[model samples]
Target: MSVTLEKVDLSLKYTAYYKQVKEELFEGSSDILNAQRSKAFQSFVMQGIPTRKNENYKYTNLHPSFSPEFSFAHSKTEKEADLQEIFRCDVPQLNTTLAFVYNGWFSRKSSAIDQLPKGVILDSLESISKQQPELLSRYASLADPEEDPMVAMNTAFAKDGFFVYVPKGVVLENAIQIINLMEGSSDMFTTQRNYIYVEEGAKLQLLLCDHSENQNNYLSNSVTEVFVGSNAELEFYMLQNQHNKATNIHSVFVEQQRDSRVTTHTASLHGGLIRNNLKFILDGENCEANMYGMSFLDKKQHVDNFTQVIHAKPHCVSNQLYKNVLDEQSTGAFAGRIHVVRDAQKTNAFQRNNNLLLTDEATMQTKPQLIIDADDVKCSHGATVGQIDEEALFYLRARGLDEGKARLIMMNAFAHEVIQEIKLEPLRERIDELVDKRLKGELARCHDCSYGKDC
Candidate 1:
């Protein structure tokens, strides 16, 4: 027999939690930042947890999964192990700079940066605030919390995350890597806020990973803001592989300027309940933006991908492609919106979502929306949900391949299109390996799990 959880008043719980946190944790923070936090908290109290009535959250519900009793702050008494041995890149040949965020705080002691150039700045957000207050003042809390409740919660509680800045006309020779490892010794609720800025004529490649060291039930809320100036380029890749008991909500907002190029790739390999919100605003002429995502979910896991691209200037282009593969009783959702303003006459936008159901009980919901106010725009959107083609599977089986092998080949081909968009070779190969393992149902736990012996 299973026990059902009774829903608690999340708003009231957060109100009490926020009051204690403000008085205990934020007493000595800068006045400007504290004011921003206060306004964001108020917005959160007014909006509350987004319900099914909210169109953006119509298919996903949080009340059933949220735990009001979890502690909101990290415990100082919790001891940490050797981070280097616990969290390392899967790619052996990848030579990149490294940074670590331990339990929602940027860990300077565990992070490594080799020969960072003159104009590039990579440090903790809290440290950067003390050293370069002007930079934080310019971009912190720039996103409107009233629009999204999760963003509001992150803003109100976010104290430390990553701060990255690339000055004009500088291209880093090596890629930057960020490893966010959650050391959950108890049931924990954590929030992290990140900021990134790329000036004109610059280029950057970033790889981010989310992993866990234990199987504790936890909730992680994260937000990132990125700005790309004129003639700049940014390639971003996000890989999520956490314990099955963890719940994650990640939001990314990007603003692009004239003649800039940005491509973002997200691979949700594993999670219990994962929601990813990605938005790109083409705010200048002749800019280009590309978004790609792939999710492999099985068992009782659920993954939601929400994306929006707004063409606010003329002669801008945007493209999006997302795919999901569900097995057993898993669930998935995709809601993508593209908007073109009236003055943006020469806009080109396209969106696509595809799903493959491997079991009768697996479910998928897809919605692609286009709102165009410009007369001279080319926009199209489509969604498809289907199973494996029997004929193709039969053809492969007839060629000396087993049934499972044939299905794996077909599914790998189906997802390779999105994987090909990743520019970094080492990271791409590593993701390919992981995705293959995921499809074979061999990846039951994270590589760095501390309790693997229990299995």
Candidate 2:
């Protein structure tokens, strides 16, 4: 039987919320856009919220973290100076930046687009919808909410967000960093939608960072849709660091054309509860995609990384590698799914998930699945969950290295596989720093737990 949203209560809530927001925000918009949003919202309302029973969300529960109601208000405060301060504190050396300040207002001052080449359009979605309505209408139509409820929520309450368009044959030299910042007093529900279109033979890099400061009971539901044309190449990265009291749901949808290449990397450092949905549809021949993710959870933090790669054409290739480090009472979930459609001959796809448990109380669930409808396709998936290697540790100690230092070295080596895949120097350095800090702290914790000796 086909799964539908009518069987869930959260689906009802999503439907109700979509209706209210549709009337308030999207009523007078273009009829075509409204119809698309309506269909997506209806799909969300019918499917309801994902739960453990859902194969895609078997390891992560969405009910408890998403129960709070979010308001649909463009609440911009007078403290622009204060909010600006928070943005600069994160990555001061970042040259090309795009800031999306929701629950306050979008700002152009904080963004650096002076060096962007001609034929490349980088602006807010709100402005694009007004100035270039046709492009917005065409690209916005690509989002499908029935397949993803969080995406539907973002569309129904779509506010301000960054938009990028690369004209045919254009190659961007520098990376574009899109940062979403949310801060407020009342219970805030901020929804931002972004659309990126890379024309034929165009190449670009996009970095997305989600963050908030001192916001209690805040919800950030974001959706980003990308279109990669023939022979185009695009690299996308996401970094999420939010307050412990906040909740985040981030969704990314990409459609790749013939001979296109796409790469995505996601790093989750801290959050109260976080869920990421990364999906890609290889709709053309000879398309390639690579997805990598790493998450570090500590102190009761929860994180879920869900990825799906669909091979709809022949001669397509996809590779996914995800790693998680759990400490204290934290929990981590990794679910990677690969679907090969019929007639998608000679497809090559591989997915792997590895987890490292730093504490006895830390928990993790990993499920990697492959659904093959084509007989000629080669696809495989594997998952492993284990603690530190005791034999390896003893060997390192026997080599005259202190136990604590030995453990840190092994931990870094364990995570180096995914870290080495990062092509950008700035991002790689930042990730190295975060990983080093976590490893040091974990080593200290282990020393304290042990009786004056490293384990």
Candidate 3:
């Protein structure tokens, strides 16, 4: 299953493929999306694939993941089964406004969203561009294609993604859930570019679930851009559970205005190779941002999470926490950076990363950074990578528990700090149940076709 592309193949092969599919890529696309394809392709050509030589990607090697030749997903495939009936969140007491994305294209079922609020827009990016182009005017404004090749590649190849816009002074009590499903009969690649906008004094909660079916080899590059206006609040959460043959590059950029607040949580349960890039720019006074992430890995999985927060204005606060648990020969990494501009006074930033290695071969690397140019800012960061506490395990064993149970209890306790921070009660409980099952060597039920409790 391991494939390698030589240096020439890695560079020229992708370049040639892009040219071969030039017409398909631009067919039925919005002017906003097609206008930047040329420049974005040029940037991708210059940057190429990232490797360990890059300081930010020093731990994870992505070249081999790209070696596999895959057919790109230009449009939605024929639906064999109803996605809603085949897949459901199955969380008790969890009510949500649900939507589905088949491969990289938003499903037609989702386009007919019902029971919506007034002045709220949630629809396909391509449809919105054609119907109301002004809604997506802020697309790609926060993400920089020139800096990261993955972003550039998505910018160049992505035709459409989901879009959401909330009018000023409106608050939606129900949470919006978007399930992104990747299923195919052969190896394939997908790209999705989502844009979200919340006007002043509006509130919204969004949840994204990523799942794969049929065990096909899938590689997806998804980018999301969010803007929180003055006096607005937004809560975002992502759950990733897929087969081991999947690779994902998830990027998110958030920009907050004055007196706005944003909180995001990400849980990585299973995947072959996962890379998460999250950045926040606090562009106004009295803005706050909080981010939390956790990963559970086994087998030959590899996960890397990189984050950055820029405090560009005074009186802004930011906090970040990420934890990982690795078993077997799995490996993971975390790199978090916080930056305070020279003129941003009275800023407070904090970051922490912790990891637990369950086996001798398991590996973890953590780096926490803080760059403070303001004289009156307060900043701090810390990281730790080690095994679980033997004393705690022994104590649990002495209380008539077996070794495996004792270890599981300790690991669960360590991860509870981040899980308890989730604001959704049903989601928090479901994740707890899923984590317990994952620790017990059983995957969760969203994509497990058996429909049995054990996968």
Candidate 4:
């Protein structure tokens, strides 16, 4: 009875809060963004936060994560800070155009805005929407807010997030890195709505890093929409490292045009109750989309990764690979769905989910689904969940290495396939080092973002 009461209260609380703050939520938001709020709020009221009853979220229970008392108002009003000096990337020779989003708002002190190529734009959604309202409105809701309650809630509450635009034929030389840092004195909730558009013949590489300055029980819901124009190429990477008191929810929607290519890598180093929703739509023929993800979880941490790939055009190709290493009492889940429509003949899609359990207490659930209306398409999916291969471990121990070293070696070899898929040389090396430290039962350091500059 208490559980049911808590669930009902959570829904009613947020709904009443929205009704009270509806006017304030529109104060500084873009007109386009505000125009969607009423409908989005209605959807959120209809669908509340997804529970285990939802097929897409069957393995993860989100009640405790959302039951906490969190303030939706921003308590700090500081305009800018020396964020670079505070959260510097320690990987030597890893140069990137850097931007920062402090407490869900794009910082005014980013150095990358001016360094970007001519005709490239990197600014906040509200700021850019005033100038490019048509562009933002066209692609902002590509993922469809009505389909996902989380998307609806973010659409209702989001006021600002970064907007990235690469003009037609323009190519970015340096990868653009956006660091989202959450810091506050009280338990808080944050939302971000971001958009990325790469025009025809353009090329872009983007890195997003999520980190929390302190463990203040932060909850953040973010949504990003991307459009890859014909003949364009995009490489996107995400590094999530936060304290165990934080809850991070991220949903990304990407649409690819003819002959466009996209590759994404997500490394979940640490977090508490992290959920990632990725949807890719191959809208044009000959388009290619690839996704790779790896996570190392320990303690009571929970991570859920859900993906949907829609092969809407003929002759499109898609691939997905996800792996997780769980230890202690940690739990994880992965649900990958591939949809091929009737007109999507000659489509090719493959997906695999593999997990390793270091302790008996660790648990993982994987579901791979294929819904096809075209009988001519080639699609396959597989999932595996188990402990380390005893034979491989024994063979390594027989090679004269200590037991600890041998176990670490096997874990590294198990994760090598996905690590090698990273095309960014320096980033790959850094990720390799982080994973090595994690397997060794030491702090991964995560690009030293949490430590002071000296470390």
- Give the least accurate 10-residue stretch of model 2, judged by summed lDDT: 446-455
> Compared with the true structure, what per-residue lDDT tens digits does model 3 show for residues 1-455?
22334654685677788888889888889888888898999998887777676788899888767777788898667466676676776667788777788889887674336666998878888788777887788533888898788898999888878888888999988888888888777888899998889889999998899887776688999999999999999999989887788898999999999999999999999888999999999999999999999999999999999999999999999989899999999999999989999999999998989999999999998888888899998898889888989998899999999999999998898789999989989989989999888888876654435443421
- Alpha-carbon TM-score of each model against the true structure: 0.95, 0.87, 0.96, 0.96
- Residue-level lDDT tens digits of model 4 in 34-151: 8889999999999988888878778878777777788874322443558777677555677788988878888857445898778898988778877779877665368577798899
lDDT of 3: 0.86
Q: Whole-model lDDT, candidate 2?
A: 0.75
User: Which lDDT values do the candidates have, in the order given?
Assistant: 0.83, 0.75, 0.86, 0.86
Per-residue error for 39 in candidate 3, Å, reads 0.3
Candidate 4 Cα outliers beyond 4 Å, as residue runs: 73-76, 449-455
True-vs-predicted CA distance for residue 288, candidate 1, Å: 0.9
Tens digits of per-residue lDDT for model 1 on 33-121?
46678888999898877777779988777765566467765322223655556666556677778888887888777777445789698
- List the candidates ranked by TM-score, beginning with the highest: 4, 3, 1, 2
Better of 2 and 3 by lDDT: 3
